[model samples]
Target: MRLRTLLRSSSAVVLAPLLAGLVVLLLRADGTLHPVPGYGLSVLTAAHSALPYIAAACAGSAAWEGGRLKQGRVFEQAPARGRLGIALPVLAPVWLMGLGGYAVALVMAAVAADGTAPDLSRPPIPAVAALLLLAATLTGYLAGLVLPRLAAGPVALVGAFWVMAFPASWQTPWPRHLVGNPITGCCGVGQAVAPDTLWAAGIFTAAACAAALLTAHRATVGTAVTAVAVLALGTTLAAGFGQRMGYDGTVPRAAAELACDASARPRVCLWPETPGRTAVVAQIRTETGRLGAAGVPVPAALTQDPAGGPDTGVLGRTGELSPEEVTRTTAAALLPAPLGCEQPAREPLLGWLTAVATGEPPSDARVRAVLEQPRAAQSEWFRAGRDSLTDCGRSGVR
Candidate 1:
């Protein structure tokens, strides 16, 4: 078949509308356009959002091509060209359509990010999506060869959709992690997708593609045994790695070199990408000063870095550095770290401290009454509550 003729008859016509719908969905959801802050984040978001549609299209198209070959009795007459050689020309357009859609999605994401340079430290999400698409195509082709011509395309399409979409809703977190879908709750400036997650998805999808290709080429008993062994090993290794990941599929990003405001007491440091660095630093300093004046201890240095030391205070990596947000975060930072056990008074203490630091009335009646005490007595009560937080062995507000 000529390349032009194959393309003219292929499922690219169907895929165009699907890709357009995806674009429209994204645009409607986001509303206004602003450049995404990081390169890795843009790639991750684009590839994940495009995967289901592209995978479904690829699978359906491949299934149709496979059915066409079966109907024409091409396999029975095969002595002129190798099976792979014959299949390659027929499947090439389907592969091109899927990859072309993915490439367009990536380009759109880059444009949204104002063409930011790639962040090398992040996992290769775009490559993972490509591999998964190949797996979908092979699996679909295999299904078509086995099933009736009329039923093959629709069945493959639904099966592909289910494989990509249903795992996300499963109660078992590990299965979702291995499906090559983007991890849930991934990626703020302070966090990245766990490497284990990428490894699992990569291994499982690659193994699936290999097995599907081998089985499609030759359905011999030996080939079946080899395919089963490959799949079993891949599943075992993928599950081993995936089970270690949390439901959220993210981990604290390694600390990067930060821009610091050195002159302030208790120096303030922020990621270089942070907007309005001077205002953010000043707000942090002002809030920490309020905590100190209220007789609450503060960390010697405050940082926005995820990997900051135990003694160092941490600020939020997302959102605007508004005064209220700064005061709440600064006040919370002064609290004792979790002792791996419950501290009964911790909530009340945090509420009281945040109220005091923000110069707002305490919400709890008990906290309000404590605040009405004489200055010396109030200080004593505050000190006692603060101490109780670090000592899980201790109890009570007084």
Candidate 2:
């Protein structure tokens, strides 16, 4: 088929609308954006999630076109151009259209990611999308050559979707990691797509492409053997090295590193990426100093740990605190230990500390009574907080 005839085909007519609808669906499905989180990363992730479907559709379209050519007996004509040359024009339109769809989705995602910077260190997700598109179409073309026209299109579509989707469902790390959607949960500001996961995905898709290309035009025994070997090798590499690191998003080590105010009497450290870094650090330093002056045993330095979680670390949620909240939170963090899981002193100890920090102790009599205790006795209660918080059945608290 000539270029003009190919462009004017019904299959080509449907490409634009299909791409547009997919892009619209993806943008709407990206969900709500929370401030101060990984806006850029999330947008990219949404694009990554949406591209697989588009690639699959393009592969199906390629199969349909291949069927049309075979039905028309174009390959039997044996014209000046070789079989691959004729096939190129037919598949090129689908390839370009698929790429165009991805480009549009990526740009839209970038717009959605506005106001937040993405970690530039993230793996090249677009590269993976390109490989998927190529692999899917090549495989589809091979299917069209072998299967009936009606069967080829749907088979290619469903087959491509299954290969991409099934791996994501497995509980095992290797399967999910090799599927190319490594970071499943929302990409928070502190996270980056793991590099090794992307590499595994790339290798898998690239190998599939090699196999598909070899099998598309010929089916010799040697070619069949080589194709199978290539595919197996790719899967092995993906499943093997793919799991060297966990598929869950990696915390950017640099972002997690403490950024501290050195001049403060009790040094205050915040996560490097904490929003409002300067103000948050200054406030924490001031509150920790106040607690220390009040004879509360504040640590020499307060370190902000985002992964430490609210009740377990010295500081957490620094990006989301008000000045007053900081004072109270800092006091809670400075408690001799995290609120213990055990009882006895739990409520009373928390009450005493809250009153000390806020000057408004809880109205509960149990809490008030702890506040009314002598300073030395109050100190003992504070010191035992960690031990009490420890889970009772485990190794006894140190």
Candidate 3:
């Protein structure tokens, strides 16, 4: 009897949303810009993540309405071994049903960042988090049946909503990486807090979920482990790594391998490489001028990989910067920040970068020599003075 109740209730709850969510997924995955059904598709795509748990709650409700399945009426009266085995297995499908929507959200989030997702074929954290949250919410819904229908359903809905909303501000490292986050803004999935390694967070979240279920089973209903609840709290209190919440920041993957030594100044590493080289090198000279002006020497290589770069107080190689980036960097190097964009925005720094990135010659090659050399005051560029390279104008400069 309990078996019939479980089967019927679970099927009804999961199948309905599964159908709806599938439609949403299909329409979204289908060719671009269709209509009508396309409208439903878009709406669901937006809120589809929270739908699965709602379905699960409805399943719980269906079981309750079955009368004999409610509370311990029929299931508890059955043999404990068979009952436990059957009950445990029932949880698996709903968790899985939660997956489709989870995948959609995760993928979309990644695409939103970088305008493309890396081929990160690792296990999905958000899906697993969704399953865990769904399972816990089911427990709450089932146990709270004494509440009115309006109250009961709303609990699951609100829960799904909250789970979707909160994790972003708290961007904890491992824990946040383990779960699907709803608060990520338009910023893409891993854009804000990508994990250094998926294995750590994935394994732990799985273990935590298992422990939650096992504890609930062993201790009886009212004594259920507060594992999920506690985990949520922990998520709230967690801090980001270094400064990025444990993520290595938004450094592009291509930023690796950019380097420069004291003898050889680093410049942009590019595709068909040299196209960006002239502009970048010139910008570096301009950028170094800022430090020199302030009496601090700057390096020829303004390369900086926000995630991994030389500790030499230089920007380090952020791989190759485009002509545009060269211009920007040159400007950044020349002027001190808290830049006043208020006026037409003419600053030495801005002019420097603009000149370099735009393929114009820098103001002076002599300045370049001085700036690139370790000794700020002694380099040929500085000593030869600022006017030596009238030809530096078209070379690159702001």
Candidates, ranked, TM-score? 1, 2, 3
Decide which is better by TM-score, 2 or 3. Answer: 2
The per-residue C-alpha lDDT of model 2 at residue 203 equals 89
lDDT of 1 by residue, 252-366 (tens): 7666646778897888877665666688788777767877777777888888775668668877544346666666667666776668887777777777777776678977888
Q: What TM-score, over all chains together, does every model reach?
A: 0.85, 0.78, 0.51
**Candidate 3 per-residue C-alpha lDDT over 58-167 given as tens digits, one digit per residue, 9 for 90 to 100:** 43433333222334454566656553354554554454445554455434433432233422332343444454545443453343344454455456445544543444
Residue pairs that clash (backbone atoms under 3 angstroms), model 1: none
lDDT of 1 at 67: 89
Candidate 1 lDDT at 154 equals 93
For model 2, the stretches where C-alpha displacement exceeds 4 angstroms are 1-13, 29-39, 78-85, 115-123, 242-253, 256-279, 300-314, 318-355, 363-366, 387-398
- In model 1, how large is the Cα lDDT of residue 319? 39
> How close to the true structure is residue 293 of candidate 2, measured as C-alpha lDDT?
51
Q: Compared with the true structure, what per-residue lDDT tens digits does model 2 show for residues 28-95? A: 66363232343555566656666667767877888898898889888778766767777878888887
Q: Alpha carbon lDDT of residue 388, candidate 1?
A: 84
lDDT, each prediction: 0.73, 0.68, 0.40
On the 0 to 100 scale, the lDDT of residue 341 in model 3 is 29
